[model samples]
Target: MKNSIFFTALLATTISLASCHNSNAKPVISNEIASIEKTSVDGNTKIQVALLLDTSNSMDGLIEQAKSRLWNIVNTLTTLKYNGKTPDIEISLYEYGNDGLSAEANYIRQVTPLTTDLDLISEKLFTLRTNGGSEYCGAVIQDATKQLSWGKDNDNMKLIYVCGNEAFNQGGINYKEAISDALKNDIYVNTIFCGNQQDGINSYWKDGADYGKGKYFNIDSNRAIHYIVTPYDVQITTCNERINNTYINYGSHGYEKKQKQAEQDRNAGSVSSANYAERTVSKSKAAYKNDSWDLVDKMKDDEKAIDKLKKEELPEELKNKSKEEIKVFVAKKSKEREAIQKEISELAKKRQDYIDTEAKKTKTQDDLGNAISTSIVSLAKVKGYSVEK
Candidate 1:
């Protein structure tokens, strides 16, 4: 039995089902986030994944599944270690086939570039809306391959997951040529057909996966995702709130960004308590870095970051303080954050152990999260990576 397929979903799986299919509904998250610069951490090895999701009227379930499983997928990826070193993991999202998008661009939008900002990823994931439009799989694949800043390191793991129910070869651009370009960059393209297995094969979904040297899966997108409640859940979620209080916000948009962090916490909980706990575990990991705004994390990348800050950039609490005073405050917050994260990490391990033991009693079903999580671990092993356990 696979480690992730069962234990993972109990941590995976939800979103506001009511508005998911509304074509005219506006994005729940603000679109004024353009001024924030996209940032990444320098690492010897990294794992980059691009999610190309179909947002046509009929594929609303697919979008919901992606939202429900985002944290679980992140947690699963964090378990991988390459030669005992944790690789920086970046996830990029793209939405295609939404009528609201520009037709000149083939109804596709690059929601975000690859980044380690898990909060930004969650914000974008929640804003995805479904509308009637054409799903050009080939074009989306080609754009993602060229647009995103894929790593050049030989050991970097690059992957693309395109999920849709439409015919694979629907657009002017040939799927074969697009996947070939992805292969040139050492990127594997996986296909998730939102229907029957044989139906997906009939639509050439399997061939697209084969052409890219990746896995192919078929799933019932409309089925509700199931989760396992654990005894450690309440304790872990309580820690999430305590950890949030440790973040010291800075910069012009510091306060708003901090609020967004709390909002994302609520969004995860809205899905289910299990998902909320999984997200807390992800926040405790290294990949959830927020150095761009959070002073605690910002100081890690540059110890003298306080010296570079303008008086106006400092938050209200730090405004009138001397440089030494500010440093002492940030140091205190950082220490608190570290202690809280440690507690959450330890609890997370116990939570997973409980999940694993209970999972053996039931059968596992393949959903968006399961398919991605299982493949991530398996592919990482093939690239000489190992699970921390």
Candidate 2:
């Protein structure tokens, strides 16, 4: 009986071991598994851009170029897909120069609000005409600070490109305040200085741009005009075609033809007599000297209207509504009223801010220009280069 019991225990242990081995064995199926999974990062990100343009009389051609090249810019941006997707972009435009004394009409208009529709932006650009007093860096910065809807999303990149021929820092608010505000909001401000001479103003603009975490481009007005008329790609392609056909066509002389054509294309549609005449007429028609003062008066009137609205009695219909209905109605009405009030307030503030920030400043145009140039030179030195004065 003992031997039989021992044999039974050994048999049970063997079966248990076999069961564990079978469970641990790998599967041997002939089936195939396919995965259709695609990896992608979550959330839609966007680039917010504010175009601060100099609308002074001198920037007429620049404005025209910007308007014409806007579509090309948009197309280029579209080609630069981020994370295998096109990024959403919002563009806003502000022109300086309508205000007199660098203060009153500094910011002429917010032509296009921050928006994703590129067509709308294009339309706004077409409508923009240069007719302003001067460029006020501080006023533009302050206006942007108060008006622009920035810092709404962490992933969104905010950029401001201020293009002008005038010196920066001639306005009321100093460079420090503008730079600080821009950095605080993570907004990069690029200064594109379009001028004939290299002066100290360029350096100041570059310094402000650096402080705002942005880039600077010094564009010669003459060269810029040529670029606007002749697209870069056209020039490259034409040159290449000429080089390839040099042996077969005009031999060595064919090269001269190509060079001539390129030069002609580059010099095409420059500021001619007719162009200047048209621009002069446009300027005369769009002069804001009289209209600006009228706008100031209108702003005052709007303020008084807002004050009256605040003090006026509530409408009977709204006053006698049920508690829930009143709550909903009041909410809607409040939002609408707030929007109007905010718009008016911004308009008023924009005017006053320009005046206060630019008009009252003691800095001369040349002084500001020199300061900017020095700043750029210092930056260049730090970056291991010698900047000639």
Candidate 2 local lDDT, 2-116, one digit each (tens): 0111111111111111111122322121111000001111255555668877766666566666653453344323333334544555567777654321233343345545655
- After superposition of all CA atoms, the RMSD between model 2 and the true structure is 32.8
Per-residue error (Å), model 2, residue 238 = 22
Instruction: Report lDDT (CA) for all predictions.
Output: 0.83, 0.44
TM-score on alpha carbons, each prediction = 0.90, 0.46
Q: Which stretches of candidate 2 lie over 4 Å from their true place?
A: 1-43, 99-105, 200-203, 222-389
lDDT of 1 by residue, 1-389 (tens): 00111111110112111121222322222233333225766656999999999887777688888989999999999999988999999888888776666666676777777878888889888877677788889988888887678999989999999999989998777999989989999999999999999999999999999999889999999988888899999999999889998888898888988999999999999999999999999989988888888999999989999999999999888899999999999999899989999999999999999888888899887899999998888888888899984
Query: Could you tell me which 10 consecutive residues in candidate 1 have the lowest summed lDDT?
Result: 1-10
Instruction: Rate residue 23 of model 2 by lDDT.
Output: 22
- Give candidate 1 regions above 4 Å deviation: 1-37
Model 2 is weakest, by summed lDDT over 10 consecutive residues, at 32-41
